[model samples]
Target: MPNLNFEFTEEFALKMDQNDPLRSYRDQFYFPKVNGRDALYFCGNSLGLQPKSVKTYLEKELENWANLAVDGHFEGEDAWMYVRQKSKPALAQILGAHPHEVVAMNNLTSNLHFLLVSFYQPKGERTKILCEAGAFPSDQYALESQVKFHGLDPEETIVELAPRAGEHILRTEDILAKVKEIGSSLALVMMGGIQYYSGQLFDMKDITAAAHGVGAYCGFDLAHAAGNAPLKLHNWGVDFATWCSYKYLNSGPGNISGIFVHERFADDQSLPRFAGWWGHDEGQRFLMEKGFIPMHGADGWQLANSNILALAAHQASLDLFAQAGMEQLRAKSEKLTGYLEFLIDEISGNSGILEIITPRTASERGCQLSLLIHKGGKAVFDSWYAHGVVGDWRNPNVIRLAPTPMYNSFLDVYRFGKILEQSLHDFA
Candidate 1:
C-alpha cells in the first residue's frame, strides 16, 4: 500500500473526511455526547453505538405483538415463527457463506456450548481441546466445562498455545507447529477469530487447514472478527463458527448471536446434537411427534423460536450493512485503521511510554489497536475517559481503540489523538 501523504493537521483530517465516500453514515448512529458534543468513540470493539433505525424497527414488532398476541407467530410483518430468517442474506454476505450455512439465534457463549455438544467429540487419544492462552474468560469457562462434562480433567485435556517469550502476539508458524506436534491428541481447534486483548487476527484459513490435516474439528469465536474482518467460513473449509452481534454488528447490547456450520454437516444426521422442538423439521414441527427429525442446514442447530424484538433490531443494522456492502466497508476500513495507526505512531515517536501490542500489518489486524502504556497505566486510561475518549481499558495497562468504519470518521480519530496527547502530557 502506498502512502496517502498523511499530516498531523486538522485540515488534513477534515479534508480526508470531506473526501470519504461513506461520510454520511455518521449521522445514522446515536453517539454518546461529551460536554454537549459527540464524544470521540473508539470502543466499537466493546460495544457499538446503536443505529437510529432500531426504534422504528422495534416499534413495528411492538405494534404486531399488541394487536395479534399469539397470532403474531403466523400473521403480521416478521411472522414471529420465522423472523430470524430475515437476517440470513445479510449475515451470509458478511460471513461469506451460503444463506443456509448462517443463522441468527442464541447469544454467542450459548451457541458455542451448543456447537461444542456436536463438534467436541472426545474419544480415544484425540480428547484434548486446543485454544489460545489468555482467551476471554467466558471461552475459558466453556472449554473447561466441556472437558469436564466428558469426565476428563481440563488440565490434561486442554492444550493452550501462547506467544513466544517476550512477545505480545503469537506466530502463525508456532501455532501450526504445535498443531502438528499435538495432532492425534487434539480433538478441536477453537480460538477467537481476532484476539480480544492483543487484537491479532489469526490466519484462520491456514489454521482450519491445519486442524483438518490433523483430523481434528475446527471452529472460531468471531466476537471480535465477524463485522470487523473479511470472513469466508464456507470457502475456508471451517467446520463451524459463532459470533456476538453487539460489537461490530451494532445491534443492541445482549442481542442475539450468529452461527455457521459447514454445508457438509448440514444433513449429517449421524452427528450427535442436543435436540430441540424448534430444530425439528418445520413441516412436522407442529405435529409434536415423538421422534426428532432435524431441519437441514444451520436452522437445525437452533434450539428455540426466534426472538422477534432482537431480530428486528438486528435486521435494522443488517439492512444498513446490505446497502453499504462489505467490499465498500472493508475498503474504507483498511484506510481508516491504517490512518489511526499512523497517527498513533506519530504521537508516540520513540517515547518508550507506550507500545502497540497488536500486529502492525494490515492483514494481521482489524479495526481495534491495543496500546500498552509503559508508565501511567490505569491513571492515564482514566484521564482519557474523563476527556471523552471512549476506548476499552484492560487490566495492567492496555487501551483498545476501534475506529469503526460504519460510524467513525477520520476526524473522530484525529480528535481522539489530540485527547490522547493531552493525557500523556498531563500524566508524564
Candidate 2:
C-alpha cells in the first residue's frame, strides 16, 4: 500500500499523473460524455469504459465470418472452435492460475450454476453452504435454486453471514470463526472474492484453508475481484471460481465470463458434471459418441463452443492486460484509490452528511470506495452527475466510485473531489 500522505491540490494530482507508469493507458479507452465534456468516469466497478480497439477486433471476426462461413470454425487464424485458448494465457496471469486451469465460457451466473453442479455436493449431515449476506442478487438466486434443486429447503441449506452490528465490512477473524462454527455441516464455503456493496476484499487464502480443514469445498464469485484485485486461485487451493468480463475487465457489457477449476480436479473423471459435446475429448468429439468422455482440466466444464465475436472483443482488452501486467496495474490502483479515499475524508470532514463505508486499507479493497449517503441521498448523486461525474448509485443510499488504474488518472480523482465538494455544499 502507498503512504496515505496524499495532497489535496491539483498540482499534486498532476505530478502524480506525470509520474504514473500506466498513464498512457488512459488514452486507450473512450469515456462517456456529460453535457459537452468528457465525464470523469469512476464506475469501473459497475461497467468499464470501452477500449478503442474493440471495433477493430470485432471487424476482423466479422470479416472472417463473412468470407469463411462454415469454415470459420476451423480455417481462420483464430478459429471459433479454439478461440477459448486465446484468452487463457492472459486470464491465467490475471487470475494467478495455470493456463489449463482456467477457461473463458458462459455468463457469471451460468458458470456458477455449472460449478455448483460439481462442487456443491450435500451428503448426510453435511448439507449447508455459507456465503456473505447481501451478495449480488444473481448469486443469491443461483444458490437458492441450487438448494431447491436438491429437494432441500434454502432456509435450512444455506447460511448467510452478515457483518457485525454497526459494521459495514466483514472482518477476517469473524469470517474464519463462522467457517469453523459451521464446520461439520458445511457442504461448501462460497462467497464473493470482494463484497460488492462494501468494497471489502476477503482473505481468500485463509478462508480456503479454514474450509479445507473443515472438510468442505471452497469457491468464489470473482465478478468484482477478477481484474480489479490480485488473486491466486491455484496457490490458495480454491476448488472453483468464476467472473464476468464486463466490469473491470473492459469487455463489452454482459460479455462472456471466465471459470477456474483447480488442476487437482482436472482429470477426476468420476466427478459429476453436466456434460456437453464441446467438453468431450477432441479425439472422440467428432464421433458422435453416446457416452460423455470429458476433457482434462477446466476445459472439461465447457458446455458449448466459444462465442467468436464476444471472444474477439474480450481478446482486445486481455491483450492490454497482458501488456500492462497485473502487478503494475495493481500498484497504480493502490495509490489511485488511496488518493480518492483521502480526498473523500478531507471533504466530508466532521459533517455527518456522508460516510465512506468501504474498508480503509488497500489490502482490504480493490479500486472501489462505496460512499454511504446520510443526508442529500440521490439529490447529491444527481448533482455529481450534472457536474459530469459518472458513478454508480445503488438502490437506497450508496454511491460507488471505482478509479480503475487501467484508464483512470490522479487528475480524474482530483476533479471528482472538487465536484463532490460543491455538490455536498449545494445539497446541504
Candidate 3:
C-alpha cells in the first residue's frame, strides 16, 4: 500500500529486527500484553516499561531493611545512609555532568523550586520570569508562585513566548530573538528542554548563551529529554535543571528526580537558600548545632534523608543506563523514531488527515513523534488503544508515541504501522 521502494511487511520487519544491535535489551524489560499478545508499546514518553532486574534489585534493599532495622542506614550492601550516592556516577555520564554537579533528590518540580529560591532572585527592574507559553502546569504554577512570593503579580512578572499564528512548534531563532529582546528585564529563562506535546527539542546550549548575554539565568525542565536525548548540561553552561526518572529512565512511578547545578556555584553556599539539616556538612551533622553549614556541591541541596526504597529502585535503572550508555542508546533511538516517521508517512500519503507535528530532522527531536489526527481525533486514538497499540493522547487531537530504544524493537514499529492503518480504516 505504501508507494515506496521498500515493502511494508512482517518479513521486512523481522529482517530489520534480526539486525538490530539493541534487540537483546528488549528481553531485559517486562512488557505488558493485550489479548495475550505483547502490546505494541509506544508509551515510553509517558511511562517506560519495568526493567526485569528491578524486582531483584528492590528485594536486596528489602532484605537489608528487614534484617538490619535501624542499622540498615550504615550496614548492608547498599547502606541507606549514603544510598543516594550510588546513582551519581551513572547520572553524571547520562547528563554530561560532574558527579558533584548532579544530585538524586525529590520530584522534578520540588527541585525546580529549591533551585529557583537561589537562582530566581529578582532585583529591581530585572524582576521578570520568562517561560514558554503552555509549559507543563506544574512549571507554570511554580513560576507563578515564585513571582508572587517576591510580591510581584504573576500577570506582570511572568513573560511567555507563544508560537506564531497557525504554527505548531517554536523555532530556535524565534526563542533566541525573544531572549535578546527581553535583554535586561528578563531575570530568568526556564523552559522544558524538550517540549512535551510537540516533541520539539530546544537548543539548550545556544539558548543558555543568549540568556547569559542578557544577564539572565537559564534553566530547563528536562522531564521528557533527560534519558531521551544526549544532554551536555555541563559543557552547555546551563545554570540548573531538573528531571523525573519514571518516564524514559525506566524507573517506577514517582521515582526520585535528578538535578544539575553548574560547578561554578558548587561552593557558593553564601547564596540564599532554604536550608535543611541533611544539607549540612555530614561530618558535623550530628552535632545538632544552631548554625547551618551547608555541604559542598549539589549535596548541599538535599532537604531530606534519602528515600531509601525509591533510591534502590532508581539505582536499578541507572545501572542499566551505565551499561548501555547514552551514545549507543541515542544512535538507535534516532533510527527507531525515524522508522516511525517513515511508517506514518506511508499510511498518510495522499491524505493529509494525520499530521506529524514533531520536527522531521533527527537532530530536532528525541524518540517521540506527535501526530495530529484531523478527523475522528480522539476517537482514532481510542481505536488505536483498543487494538493493543499503547500510546498517549494529548488534548485537542494529538497522539504522542515514543518507541524507546531501550525496550522497543524494529518489529514493534512495523506492527504499530499495521495497527495504525487498521485504526484509520475503521475510523474512516
lDDT of 2 by residue, 1-428 (tens): 55557998999999999999999999999999999899999999889889999999999999998999999888978888888999999999999999999999989999999999999989999999999999999999999999999999999889999999999999889989988998999999999999999899999999999999999999999999999999999999999999999999999999999999999999998789999989999778888969988898999999898888899999999999999999999999999999998898888798788899999889999999999999988988898999999999997999999999999999999999998888767867
Question: Which residue pairs collide, candidate 2?
Answer: none
What's every prediction's RMSD, in angstroms? 1.0, 0.9, 2.0
Model 3, residue 94: distance off in Å is 1.2
User: Candidate 1 local accuracy as lDDT?
Assistant: 0.91
**Cα deviation of 292 in candidate 3 (Å)?**
1.4
- Answer with 2 or 3, whichever has the higher lDDT: 2
User: TM-score, each model?
Assistant: 0.98, 0.99, 0.97
Model 2 regions lying over 4 Å from their true place: 1-4
Worst 10-residue lDDT window for candidate 3 reads 1-10
Highest lDDT: give the candidate number.
2
In model 2, the Cα lDDT at residue 290 comes to 96
Clashes of each: 0, 0, 0
Query: Candidate 3 has what TM-score?
Result: 0.97
Error of 3 at 234 (Å): 0.3
